[model samples]
Target: MKILLLTLGLGLVCGLQGLDNSAKGSPKLDGKWFTVALASNVTSKIEEGGSLRIFVYNIRVYDGFLTADFFKRENGKCIPFSVTAITKEDGSNLVHYDGLNDFSLESFDDEYSIFMLYNIKDGEVTIWGELFGRTPDLPDEIKKKFEEICERFGIGKDQIRDLYNDDRCEKLR
Candidate 1:
């Protein structure tokens, strides 16, 4: 009798878990979130062996790491994922916040960058810029790695799509 009762309780627990998993509302990928290039990248037309090539040293460094972030939706949905994109102080991180999809990121303290982009969607905004100083919490190795990736991916002429949309397995708002 006790064994049967235990089995019944276990079944109920499993059912409840399943219900919880399926319970969801209008999940919006809206607003900003943190993301990384899925290994695919494009290059800017002007940067094809030009004077502005070396990002760490010379050249006006037009592009840097993109650290996306966000503000809450007008509907009061909490900002999705916000991770600092760690970039050089020479520019700002620009990103386009979308109602259906976006990225959230911030690099570090006393950090700044440059960006230029436009928004083509309703209830959405695009931001892109040259980034500056990164957070002290970040390590040089990680920052260097990010720089390498940025050099490969952040070129304006490069129109490569993400290798994996769920690359970071990020949580969307």
Candidate 2:
């Protein structure tokens, strides 16, 4: 009886260890993700400080492929675009969109995730990135992580606009 109880306890411990490992990894990108902040060619055009930019990304992963839908508000109009993507490699979190856009995983936790996108063309790299969250409002740690990434990418403080207070985007589809 003692040996049986010990064995069961060990199994439970092992199972919980596995669970913890999975839980700490990057948050899944599927479902509606609100943009916390964005640093890109688009955001750099915002001349007004208080003007908020609203964006949302919806991602669906299926059968070794991913489909992403992007919606953004600009000039009092909502623009939408869709692209199909596939994982770059096995066990990699990065996804390649439409063969030109590379959405590479930067960091993620339960509340938020960051993806750095590179638009490669003719030997030039245009860098774009977004800080996405499960909710509209995120904790400070997530914000700091985004700041760190922007700094690392040589995006000046003026270039990193805060879109965290922007309204959530309406569904595009």
Candidate 3:
């Protein structure tokens, strides 16, 4: 009985430790990020004045959740917003926000990351490809890569929107 109890305690400790590590997340992902571009299978969702047309500025992870700081233009004014996504234990970085969001880090380096988001909201599914850069502007090649990714996901070139020069909420920072 004592041996069984000891084994259970050890297992519990190991489980908790794994959870803590997952909560801490990768340091590389915890930092300032700029919204360079956005594309979606549902073009209207990424179009100007769309609900998904948000400019992200920061990302941080804590307690197994990833929170993002961003701004959305409303009534010709920039409105600050924040959303938290619960990181899954499956190591997929999947999170639930306004909907079920499954994020895949398609590509990443020191300066940029392209995330493809599969979201299901209100029974409608949308796939979005987002390009985030360490700087406000990325090279044309990077943009072209993002376009190719979007195309692969059935998002047309016309659906992509460039937001590098639309930092209207910089003052709020």
| Cα lDDT of model 3 by residue, 1-173, tens digit | 44532332232211111323243343266678888999988878777787778788897756656688888888989988788764444444455655766666666666787878767677676788789998888999999999988887788898888887775377776
Pitting candidate 1 against candidate 3, the one with the higher TM-score is 3
Local distance difference test, candidate 2: 0.56
Ranking by lDDT: 3, 2, 1
- My TM-score estimates for the predictions, one after another, are 0.20, 0.64, 0.75
Comparing 1 and 2 by TM-score, which wins? 2
Candidate lDDT values, in order: 0.27, 0.56, 0.71
For model 2, what is the alpha-carbon lDDT of residue 38? Answer: 75
Off by over 4 Å in 3: 1-27, 62-64
| Local error of candidate 2 at residue 82 (angstroms) | 1.9
Instruction: Tell me the lDDT of model 2 at 48.
Output: 37
Model 2, span 1-173: residue lDDT tens: 44532332232211111112223454555677777777764463333332223365676655555666776566756777666754432222333432254445567656776766654444444556678888777888778888887677666555666666554455444
lDDT of 3 at 162: 86
